[model samples]
Target: MPLNKQFNKDVCRNLFAKDSRRLFLKRTLNSATITLAVSSGLLLPIQAIAAWNEVAFAATNLQTAIKSVLGTDLSRASDKISIKIPDIIENGAIVPVTVSSTLKEVSTITLFSEKNTAPLVAQFELDKDCIAFISTRIKMSQTSNVIAIVTARGNNYSARKKVKVTIGGCGD
Candidate 1:
């Protein structure tokens, strides 16, 4: 073989050998770390940090749902909270809804479709540093009031808007 060709072949072999060695080291280190974690009980099954309120979500009636979620059926009307939703919706399945609050220390925002089988549509938990604003889509069973309850400073404030749905999102 020519000197150049022989040199190229040797270089290619060395490159491949180095790559294989690097790969073997990486795989071995990864396996060892995983084994250590497993043996030391550091790799535990995922446990939910937040608990789900089954009763609130499962409530069929608006009053029951509100009571379960908020610990009471009563909420004071507040102008500080704004609900942006179409007065008339063509489709009930995907109704655009946005809830924003100017109230301080807003911790949670819950939505309810008054006429749905399950009145509770969605609930959001806000962090201390998070903005008290949420935009989402909710389903409406019929033409009914879309209520938004905002929890701020351990008190509940509410706002509602009447939404007319031409087609029901929830099954009739």
Candidate 2:
């Protein structure tokens, strides 16, 4: 009721007091309320945020295409993007690939196969309502890196994978 002048002793005595059923239930309920309050507070902000839908880039080679689009070098593993292609490709003319990104606010997906005369195989601009994903057949003259560049939240992220072409499609 009134401020305890001996704060330490008063607090300590209450802390060491015998536990009661009501106190336990009250403590549990307080914790649950706090948890609900914290989670709802957290979820509101995350849901309020809006995503993006535009990415752009340029390149001389597949590696640099990744850097030009993603702003960094890509890793064969552990990148935010994924590349789907046959490890051993027999026909270089029609090598299928799919690039999908998990990065938020993804706006574009581009493909580059270094062995082609024009390293930039394809470029896609997605609508705001669209997802950051695409698949297409590309021509790879020989063994080369297929790089997937994803733009998200006004930043670039990329991933790459190498494919072996047994025969040359470029007539090399």
Candidate 3:
């Protein structure tokens, strides 16, 4: 180990080489780790992160969008749910919207444009640790009612605001 000594390739190979026993042990440990992770539910599919509902986003009207998204035709208007948007939007391509709820156990927040070809604009699923708030810019076809639905405690609460658009989105 002297600083002046040249390194020996043969010695290094014998000391640190991937011999048959080492290779087999390494492979077995790796396989066991993977098996333990999957079997114990530490590893999961991508769907657990976020799942898309194609039917809901494809609904063309308010009632149908509600039924498709929430699996129900009824939702009560609630003061606890607050939707913030412009009274008039000069451009409908990017209308800013914010939805927040003071209600407890809020699990999901959905946005809808009442007159859009597909009324459903956005959907969000909030985990237990998340706050009940979402903000995003959505495209609008024309002057329409923007709706926000907050799902909490196995019920849907909603709020709506009318946005007047001077310029149309969705290819005028």
Candidate 4:
């Protein structure tokens, strides 16, 4: 190879090596810091995470599931709460759903499929500054009403939409 070409190759190889080393070092330091922090009780482990509602998820009926999750069976229909979902779902395995609310001080959003064996689909906790919106995929056993309950300022506001599932998602 020409002397100039060899020199250029060497320079490029050195630059690549330096970049790799820098990245490796950065990742190592980050891992070490996190390990130390977690060991010293400054950070909690993943297994220590809480706030899972087993009863809600295992509830068989809509009212039971709602009461288990939100501590109230009563909810008022609200125009401010919006549920976006397809009128007809070809496959029940993955139904796209979006729930959003214009209500202020929204704390939580819970989703339920009335026909599912276990009615409670998902629940999300929202921070005060965060937007009252949740987009997720849920499985349906059959054609059913998809309900969204938004908890704001200690009141439950709800909206539901009918979804026709041609093929059951939860093993018909």
Candidate topping TM-score? 4
Best candidate, lDDT: 4
Ten-residue segment with the worst summed lDDT in candidate 2? Answer: 50-59
Point out where model 2 deviates above 4 Å. Answer: 1-78
TM-score of each: 0.72, 0.56, 0.71, 0.74
Better of 2 and 4 by TM-score: 4
**lDDT (Cα, 0-100) at 139 in candidate 2:** 86
Stretches off by above 4 angstroms in model 3 are 1-50
**Candidate achieving higher lDDT, 1 or 4:** 4
lDDT of each: 0.93, 0.73, 0.88, 0.94
lDDT of 1 by residue, 1-172 (tens): 6999999999999999999999999999999999898777777444325577899889999999999999998899999999999899999999999999899999999999998989998899999999999999988989999999999989999999999999998875
Q: Model 4, range 106-165, lDDT digits (tens) per residue?
A: 999999999899999999999998999999999998999999999999999999999999
So what's the TM-score on candidate 1?
A: 0.72
Clash pairs of candidate 4?
Answer: none
TM-score of 3: 0.71
lDDT, candidate 1, equals: 0.93
Q: lDDT order of candidates, best first? A: 4, 1, 3, 2
Q: What is the lDDT of residue 19 in candidate 1?
A: 100
How close to the true structure is residue 84 of candidate 2, measured as C-alpha lDDT? 90
Cα shift from native, residue 80, model 3 (Å): 1.0
Question: Candidate 2 or 4, higher lDDT?
Answer: 4
